[model samples]
Target: MDRSFEIQCPPFDLELSRWDTVFPHWGRSFPPSHARRIHCFSLGRNADKESLVGHLHVAFHHTVQRVPFLAGSIVPSLEGGNHQRKVVPQGVARLDIRDLSHKLSFDRLAEEGFSQHLLAEVLCSTEDNTPHVCLFEANFIDRGLLLVVSISHIVADGRGVTEMIKIFAQNLCKAQAGLIGYPLETTQEVYRSDRRRIVTGNGVPGPVEAHPALTSAAAGTHSRLADVGTCCRTYRIGADALVALKKAASSAANNSWISTNDAISAFIWRSIMVARHRAGFLDAGNEVHVAQPVDCRALLGLEEPYFGNAIYMTQGSLPFADLAGAATGLSAAARIIRAQIRTATAERFRDVVGCSERAEQEPHTRMKIADDVLAGGIILTSHFKFGLHQVDFGPAFEGRHVKALRFPVRGTMVGAVIVLPRLPDGSCEFMITEQGRTVECLVDDVFCRFTAETKTAKSVLPPSPTSPSRNGQAEFVFPESTSVKESTALNMTTLQAPHTGTIKIIEMNRPKAKNAISLQMLRQLHDEVERIHGENTTGGTRVLILASALDDVFCAGADLKQRSVMSDAQVEEFLALLRETTCKLAQLPIPTIAAVAGAALGGGLELALCCHLRVFSSTAVVGLPETKLGIIPGAGGTYRLPRIVGISHARDVILTGRRVEAQEAFAMGLCNRLVSHDSSGTERGRALQAAIELATDICGGAPLAVRAATGALSLASPAGEEAAYASLLHTTDRLEGLSSFGEKRAAVFVGE
Candidate 1:
């Protein structure tokens, strides 16, 4: 039983160092921690664990056309000789981690592999362990998906190196029994038992006598991905600098019990409160959350080493109005944070999470998190003591390589408060983002009050004290970085399908007559029909999609009320164009599809019959309803209606002039597909996207094959009347279709 024989591939076992040798730039972009974990995985494709590490270079597909700051996905590593590493539409690499973690629900893992997008993002942010790591969010959209990777490099290097990531996935998958994994990096029993760590003022000592395993890095380097920024200025007060700064921070908060974190959170909160007040959102609720990281390592006991980070957050939420009151200062805000910390026990965390399942008949009022929920908020987090600064990369430089990597990530609407600790002094550093100047003033007040005596406080955005600033200015405007490049990728789409050159969309813009066509409308449509017939690359025209604006209703059907205003010659001209347009559309070289989103009655229903297939939405109402005005359908309706929905049903509806709903129209064969429309234009846009995607698939085939299929679908009445079709039988479209279809699957059409 040679287990080595079970190795997936030669590339799968390339070992971490092999990547540094094979791909020249692998070592440059990624830190050793990241490179070591993924280098063993397959690089060219998803062969094994090695590729998972190597796959970090794959870029993301972004549907958000507006964001200029972020790359949609991945920090690509491939350069130089590897042409295959270029961005191409293909399959993705997979991961073996979380092979059924109860927390991450990825049962769909068998269907698609662990998204290369997800694992690589975790790797990128896990690089450093000092900076605080923000939460990552992923959004799924109609076009594609948007993934956000936010983390503080203070936790780990830009590359998060974990034993779970470094080992080959296939090797672990084959290891089987728990005996082989005796020293599991994380265990459920240990995590469950240590869920409640103490909140002592002083940090506890390492696990020595009580337990061995718990003390061995239960908390490892911080591992999260975010683009981080820091704003810090050091201040000195004579010799005892540390003691004095702590005194000012605590004194501003006016609480002997409050730690430096509470004071910082309070300061950041007050700044935001003033900013919100000036932004004209004075009446709206402006609640901000200040989140502090909580480590449960000591609870796991002295035996644990800081192996992999296991933590949660303590959040304090305060309203902006509370800070805006003239008497309320940093001390008042700090008191609130102190109260929140007092209430924030492990039991409270469990209770809040448990409340949902244990509610007493409360109505579930949660919006869908996918498209709507989790959209807007203000969140603050700190990773001050995550020990990420200790990351050593075997002397790459005279100093450390990675630093904090985090940025204020925007949601539908979200602001941020970020904090990091300066070394030696241990005082906190902060970065804040909000919308207004009132908040900026409060932030200035907090800073001036804390470091007032002798510390030099500078700002990337300095307040204009000497300059004549606006008196009690209500708004604070941050300069926006404007650099938007329009994408030319859209124009590259070529429209060359069998039905492309044939389909013409006609919009009647007459507002007065409820958009009903009079003599002029008939003439315009008639001329366009002729142009379509002349230019159609197919031997004849195929489809015509007609629409109108009642400029409110689709059409009121006919202008019969104004018929007496016209002479007989004028009447003849109008009837001729209507008949010509209808006949031309029906005699198209292939099948046509009519889409009705509103009313289709009388002349409208008569015109609709020109198409071979009709699709109507639930909003559409269809009928002949013309004879009520004591006249029959004028356009080729009398004959074409019978040819379409059958003579029996046609006579019943046309004679009685009864209107039918969209679903009824489908049942009677007057409509082919039934679609529902939302106010969002989602259903309609999806149809267009589907159409274009289908067109893209068809365009991949030879253009001639589609043209010949158009020939076969033509509505020639009899065998003797197929002379034009006979000539096309000898064309290149026929030869390509015969050759391609004979090979099975699809016929590659080449329009010759």
Candidate 2:
């Protein structure tokens, strides 16, 4: 019989009326069944107490056995045969891996059937190999089954082997009887210096324990406690989209270094945020975390998959402070997270991950350091898929194949851990969220109505601002020389032109943290706009220019650091002020220009697009980069970027959460003009000059004509923009521009 994704069941605790059962018997150290096994396992132990174990540094993949059963084994349809109930060999797929995580995820712990393929990958075959993984393969037919199942000898004993098949059988037994199995606990070991294990041939004995890596690893960030999170979803992705996702991530990152793990983790974290938004917890402010797996092979110099929980989880947290205001900050947060992750994929961290058992290796103590992990929320991991596809059933039984499933059966999670098959398109699927109305809203506004009955806990959501310059919470100056002065005095209502011909420059400066915009800036900007409009002397400010300081950054987007400290009242104040700014920008009487040189992110970009002209330097960069922080564009980025760049490109940037360089910014028309860098009035200075030119140019026209032109260009859709753009449509260069965009080439046109 073909064994597929059938249900499994085990014992349950009925007393509490809740199945969040904890099986404390599953210890971390095992009584060795084989001397060779213990010797091999001991060879790769790491010395570091603070670093995560190097679980993935080892490789045991070479031991795979692909066994294929005749099509007749599952169905007589694949073979030319009539239906006769004669016994055929049950194909067996033995999984062998050096990693305990992959083994546990893949092993049939309660029944029979596991793969040894993991063992080959985790173990060493030659001197070049680390040699820790164990492999045993079985042949089914054209497919070979690799057995790489692992359970630390400390917990289940060799009975662990029996437990897998037994669990499978039990599940088969339960599913046959109609039930879902509860999860079995693995363990958590705390770190202490007293109770340590000693090894021979060591310079000094390993400490009984060291302090938890909490303070050192986390620094200012709070370390999350691990908890079981569960979700269920089925998804499919196209190949081209998958490639684009990686390319975009690589291009957006500094040095363009991309990895599969970071991209997947970012994707999963955002998915959880979407789910949290759906669960009527939209206003609850807390950091979202994910437990990422690290292989310890390289760190310990091991060659095979060791039979234990050799994995250590990494934290991916983007607090509400960053994401609560403008949804665009999510992507920036993700980029930071991606960078942190990029640094963590080293052999040293891997060694730290594998060293979990060093202090408690005395053979009978529980894992003490993992308590926090057991308590924290959410996990993102991958159970390599290639090996699973090749598992085989023995000829004596029937056809059987296996895919991945989560640990913590019947998961109880703030965010669940997910492992997915690598898709044909090269992207990975993640069960970060179960199907829920709340999750739907996070991914799409169409689903926002699902939580209509629930009141948000925090009402002061920051407005979305995509331009980095607009949300400057702190000050970072892009090196440029201009007559621009940043003033805290320019509050809301400060910039209304007294004369219609004047071009006003509003500089929002709260310079200390990094020139990130804040709610206060939003209010100030808004009030100044109103101030200009109310003016009689310098009346009808025909053009406006928004610029930042002059040292390093041009508004690093929203002020997440400040927003994190706000209470409900303050948050609302923040949101209110922000909304006023967007509204004012839309209503401005004359043209607007956003001048930039450096990072114009999330809110910064949002504000830039509101202007009639977005002028930038070749050194400047622009993007939404917010979803990584667990949010979408809050201001008008969702509506604006799509309207400007078309829905397709916007979706690509938003979903992938990638940043683009200055050249790319111009190519996408995210900037109206790309200028050169210089101390003698840089791109930003040119922007101010350009605004004056536009104002003078427009002043020459009938005021009525200019106002009408300005009015239509400010609409939210392309249908409206198309009409306004039509006025420029008559120009020869405009035709070239449109043609060039369509043809994927540069435009060449003579001035009309």
Residues 1-752 of candidate 2 have per-residue lDDT tens digits of: 12121111111111110000001111111112111111011111222211111111111111111011110022122322121111123322222222233333222321121112223333333221212122221112111222323322221222223323333333333332324223322112221111011111123323323312211221111123222222234232233334433333343435646555454454445444544543444443655445454443344453332222223334555664453323333344346456545444334343332332232243222223233222223445454342333333212122333332222212123344444556332434444344233333233321121111111111321222122345543211211111111124231122323223555676544445355775435544776778766755223555677776544456677788657756677677776676667767867867777777677788877778677777777678778888999988777788878877788888888888888788887887777767766678666556545545554554554343455477675665768766765656466556666788899975543323
**Candidate 1 residue 648 C-alpha distance from true site, Å:** 1.5
**CA lDDT, every model vs. true structure:** 0.39, 0.41
For model 1, where is the 10-residue window of minimal lDDT?
481-490
Best by lDDT: 2
Evaluated against the true structure, the overall lDDT of model 1 is 0.39
Error of 1 at 228 (Å): 78
Query: Which ranges in model 2 have alpha carbons more than 4 Å from their true place?
Result: 1-231, 251-253, 277-287, 321-377, 384-386, 390-412, 423-427, 433-752
Q: Could you give candidate 1's per-residue lDDT for residues 478-519 as a string of tens digits?
A: 111100110110011123345234334455544435556654
Residue 127, candidate 2: how far off, in angstroms?
A: 42
**Residue 690 lDDT (model 2):** 59
Candidate 1 deviant stretches above 4 angstroms: 1-503, 536-544, 548-553, 561-564, 677-725, 741-748
State the lDDT at 65 in candidate 1.
10
Our tally of clashes for model 2 stands at 208
**TM-score on alpha carbons, each prediction:** 0.31, 0.32
